[model samples]
Target: MRRSGCGSARVRPVLAVAVSVLVAGALVGAGPAGAADPPDRVDNPYAGARVYVNPEWADRAAAEPGGHVVAGQPTAVWLDRIAAIEGTDEAMGLREHLDAAVAQRAELVQLTIYNLPARDCGRRAPQGELSIEEIVRYRAEFIDPIVEILAAPRYASLRIVAFVEPNSLANLVVNTGSRYTATPACEAVLARGTYLYGIGYALARLGAVPGVYPYLDISHHGELGWPDNSGPMTALLLQAATTAGSTVANVHGFVANTANYSVLREEYFRADDVVNGQPVHLSKWVDWNPFVDEVPYARHMRELLAGRGFSPEASVLVDTSRNGWGGPARPTGPATRHDLNQYVDSSRIDRRALVGNWCNQAGSGLGQRPATEPEPGIDAYVWVKPPGGSDGASGQPGLGQPYEPMCDPYYNPPRGSPYPTGALPGAPPFGEWFPAHFRQLLANAWPPL
Candidate 1:
């Protein structure tokens, strides 16, 4: 809910300088309680890093009316700005993005680590074209080139905030051995740990870069939060570290809720909710009373990880782009309807079948803009998932394989009919813009867009 005036010509530079100072302060000496400080003791992660804002964002700021404010302003992109590395994407688009960072002499530029095999569980529209069998080659074709670019000497001074593989690690915990693994594709991914290997290799390689701050993705609270999924998540992190041949020490931090939406603070105030004579908050997993928001979730996970040997210096990052606009006003009583998102219980709001309501959900707003501020074990609140881009298409007739009841416009699962989530019907694919979503997001923006 942090607010700032519109992106005026006079305000942009101030914003940049403020951001630089913020990033510099956090990297140098911020460590969790009782953690040993690193010996290197660099004051600024972005110091001397050759980073710049992308020219496209600037151009849009100049030409696209409101676009100049949202577009040209900094937001991270994957592989290339548009998510694919083909054609001019590698030659021209990437250079443009990097060149802008350099032009502005930005201290940091955000980048996403996508392309894990069997990516997104084949559940969403951008499920990736790679099969589990072809993952080894995926490393060669997709990941390596990006690494080569980041590792290049020309960009040596730039601080790269690498957001590793959104939804990749969480999928390992949620879908691996469950009914979701019904397909051969899911089975292959589970058997091979395709995501773990993919993310591990990327982390080890990218983390080695002097200017890179590698943050592996830990899915949001809904997918793998406290009480329910704690043990499995701890084991997964340890396994991932082992697979990478690097310990948590090599990582700069871990990111949660990359593209998903789960507010960082739950509604419960006192952190005391008794269930069957036991306070739920007292439980190791349910560290936050109302519900486990990203802050407590990240902090608790860090503690759990420390017992297993994760670095205390490793920080947490949360993507606050869309979660700021809480979904429907908190329901007053038990849900009279079947749609899970609206269903509420006494202990918490939105007791849906799934904790995270991803999928181009409706009523979301532009969250806290990207910035580094130390709060509750988190390093920064970033807009890793660009605002206007669509999560997936609403189930319009022709789209293949991935369509589900949640996104289908004509069907509603509760009544044995399917319906799309609010913001989705008009959205495009993964990284493309959706004007409908843009209008809604701008209108619903927390600080009043």
Candidate 2:
């Protein structure tokens, strides 16, 4: 299965010239003492930078009970459709957000560039406006405008991190073949090569902007952790990086679990643990996947990318937005049971019925608050997927979002082992705020809000 999930300025005369000189010097890597460094010069864009806190998201968060605790924290601004580039009825436009970022004096801004043609092709919760044949429209109408905004002179001072199309590549890996989970939509996406073209085009155009760093999304551990899936996924990434006038140089790094709820780490159990002569990988939960959580999966994926001639400096980012499985049910230690399945289940912190269940999960909690260099290969643990945004509607269809059985808490898949979706009830459509879910996250925050 596939997982899925801006601004401006002004000035004066002499004072403006002085500000312009400072900014230009910084951009060209010729700044004097204390001037900002060029984006290429920075090893980690997040380092020593104030992450932009979108006031729009902050307002929504603050309105909820106990939401002030995380209202000020940084979350990504998602441009899911072309309309979001210009202001929508419900949200600010790309330039408006960049303008707000400038006003906030934010050193870094994150944007989820997610409007690829046939996006989320494997599922139907959040569908894109572009048809599979609309790659030109995707390039001209969607990515090109965003690239123009990002490349504009006024936003040069801000380090813009563009998460290029989460799950777009990963879907090409798992959702296209004759595998049980494959769908015709995904097959069409693969057959037409739209996802690769769209992603490569976005990366190349965005990367051309000196201030924009594009991090392609590799889906979560549950999706791409297996050897077969990870290998082909890396290959597909390289293919995309080289397609449409792009190259590996265009990729600054990659982000994993972008809106999925896979745990950042399983503190108690591991994939190699042995119980009664049976390995943990044999368990239904582990299912022979080498990774048990996102951290290892991300680090290993980085190695895979590097092995395939990606930049050795390419770092990884993990979405810690909602994978904190901290609550009374969270396991404090490994299980004492000798049975492999029992040991794996009792010791795991990811409380989802199945790792494949990507939705507004019932017991998920707020994970690690955004932090830089939290792990070896990880540049930052970020709230890329804002906490409390519904994954999809549970049952009924919403305006653009079709009803997905994966989002249904009561539905069981035909192929995967039968289990309830474990999704929270009353979820709104994807990207809509769910106040009850927000309260649940706050209450069960891992580090304790």
Candidate 3:
């Protein structure tokens, strides 16, 4: 793991500089590769060719880029961060953004309902999946809504992934009929379908069976929650693998969280010139949080299995949002105040690398990942969370609140003066970073084929 006593204060200025000229977006052709098809020149967050756009919060794209998430793929809602109430979201313009994405033709709308009482997320040293209440509520709010809508045949052509939560076996086994493309990021042609496969299928591919020494990895961790380390992540992978059956599952484990939890993050961010301007993952940015980084948490299961004489491989998915925070300190989680940030640079101690960690460098364009087969343990490392979006930002100059850091382009008060460098603006609005980074990752990291 990459280790650094660095503080967020020290990072702020660097981030400013990084967000400035260092951060740019332009779509050139993907370099050269041998794995899959040619990659997109720009760094677009929705790594796959299908583009989902919401124009309410930001300006509408004048024209949908060629293969990037264009205007015709499919449009959906942005309800994941829905507020406590339907219309009570602090950022009122969100409704507009959703509408715009829909207007842009996003076939699937994503929603993350964390407001329910069940979502208490009680403080657990290693918090597992959603609390019982959260699961119940998930059914009530999400599954139920989608099932009802699709059941009614309201939109037969309206295809969507019920809940991109880590992975829901029920969702997988219950539903079948899909397209399984070799690479998750298929442009114009990378679209395939498969039927509802189950854990059995995934297990089979990994070369296992029900009674024959169970695969002891995150996949079996019934407790890991929120996708970064446990519950949701393992659950999601199993569901996908099973569902995909012998095929690569599109599991966007929480890169941010996984990176923050692991020591690997440090190595990723330390090498600024590693990938050059090309995206490390073809999408995303970087953030380091030493405390709370979940290393071996997944491997722990492997070790446990090894203790039992199983010594099986580890299976894990990561949620790489807010993870830019890096892993936790020796014993604590991310320092809320940045004073205790124990982040690092982890380049050694190699094992199965699941996904990229903490923040990717991207801008306005479609960035693509080079064609590389998944290592024994990894299925696919994708951009689950749209990049450039602030957890909650207002999307305005000099204003970073709610999560939306700086709006795309990193606009400053002075037209020509760069941001942060020149004292001329307000805090960045919430949810603003999504578009900028989403657009950039696509433009940069796309490998040359």
Model 1, residue 407: C-alpha shift (Å): 3.3
**Each model's TM-score?**
0.75, 0.91, 0.34
Candidate with top lDDT is 2
RMSD of each: 7.7, 5.9, 17.6
Local lDDT at 282 for model 2: 87
* Tens digit per residue, CA lDDT, model 1, 207-263: 677767777777777667645466777777777766756556566777777776666
Clashes of each: 19, 5, 151
Tell me the lDDT of model 3 at 205: 32
Span of ten consecutive residues with least summed lDDT in model 2: 23-32
Q: Considering TM-score, which of the candidate structures 1 and 2 is the better prediction for this target?
A: 2
Report the C-alpha displacement of residue 213, candidate 1, in angstroms. 1.6
lDDT of 2 by residue, 238-336 (tens): 999999999999999999999888998899978987889888888998889989999888888989999998998896888888888888989888889
